[model samples]
Target: MEQNRCEKSTLLLSVVIGVALHGSYSTLFNPLTGPWSIFPLISLVLAVYCLYQRYLNQPMTDGMPKLIFSFFLLGLFGYNAYLKTSNPEMGSNFFSSVCIVIIAYGFIVKLNSVNVYVNRKKTLRKHRKQSNINCYQLLVVNTARF
Candidate 1:
């Protein structure tokens, strides 16, 4: 559990750094037609892949909302990229900012759910242990009566 938390935190940190760079460069650099474009594009692809993988790995009922949100953000990314491609003069800062916000929200939601799941597991384990002890106690009492 500790390892899982650490890994998650690391992933979250990477996402934050990627978003910060993307947002900062969107206004100053042309994200569509220069060397700077590569990093943002790569990050976008990576984000999409991660979202899709999460969607697939989780149950439909559990992941549906997140999947929908991921698609929405993906749509926005495509639209923004299109705009940038069509008109190099138009700034993509707004789009990048939007992406950053969506990613942050998604990560927060994911983290919350993970915590909830972990708690549930712990509770279930405790309940099972208690029930087992109760069953053993009842068995002993019945044997004594017999």
Candidate 2:
């Protein structure tokens, strides 16, 4: 579980960094004439792969909402890719910023939600244990009184 979390966090960071850099330089560096267009292409392909995992593997998990986020980001990424290709001059930081922030915030929200769930389970277990002990004590006292 920890390993999966670390790997996911790393992947999200990489995508965010890539988006930010691509947005910043895609204009000045003129990515259209070069191979840099591959960034969005790769992103879209990975998004498809992610969708496959979301539905093809098995019943979805609690983390399935994160996949929704990836799908949303992937859709936007495709749009940005189209705009960049169609009208290179129209590209702006707005698209890249939104994508990067969505990924970043999604990663954070997923992690925090998992943590909260784990903590809640732990708390419930503790409460149950204490209640069990109290019940046992009450039984003992009633038996003594009888």
Candidate 3:
């Protein structure tokens, strides 16, 4: 259960970070106007929440947060890429963003795998200890019967 929570948190954090970066990039390069400008604010809020989660060492267990943010980032990236398709200069920026997101995602996956392996080792050690205790108790009970 803890592992599941950790995994969820890691995924959420990654997505939030990605969105924040993308938002900042958009704000700097494209500068959304009027009501649409609220996007950067929303991204700021998410970035703060991400920091708070990290500080508290607690992550949201629900999958909704990550899913929603992931979709938002995907849409934003797609729209931006589509808009810049005709511009040759923006191609490098788009490529770099894609590479960064991929690297971050890969890192998180590797971290989660390591976390799972460590948790499994701990569980196995606990089981071994319990088995030893049971064996010792049985030995003592048999000796007492004699």
lDDT of 2 by residue, 1-146 (tens): 86566445444544454454444355447646445555655654664565456456545455555555564565447446655657757666567556756776776887798899999999999999999999999999999998
TM-score ranking, high to low: 2, 1, 3
lDDT of 1 by residue, 1-146 (tens): 66545444434434444453444356456554444435555666666576566546643445545545454555456445555656768765566567757776776888799899989999999999999999999999999998
The residue-level lDDT of candidate 3 at 102 comes to: 71
Better of 1 and 2 by lDDT: 2
lDDT of 3 by residue, 88-117 (tens): 455545664695487558558866987899
Ten-residue stretch with the least lDDT total in model 2: 13-22
Candidate 1: give the clashing pairs.
Answer: none
What local lDDT does model 3 show for residue 2? 77
Candidate 3: segments with Cα more than 4 A from true spot: 1-14, 31-36, 53-89, 92-123, 126-134, 137-146
Winner on TM-score between 1 and 3 is: 1
lDDT of predicted model 2: 0.61
lDDT of each: 0.60, 0.61, 0.63
Question: How well does candidate 1 score on lDDT at residue 135?
Answer: 100
RMSD of 2: 6.9
Number of the candidate with higher TM-score, 2 or 3: 2
Q: Quick one: ranking by lDDT, best first? A: 3, 2, 1
| lDDT measured at residue 19 in model 3 versus the true structure, 0 to 100 | 60
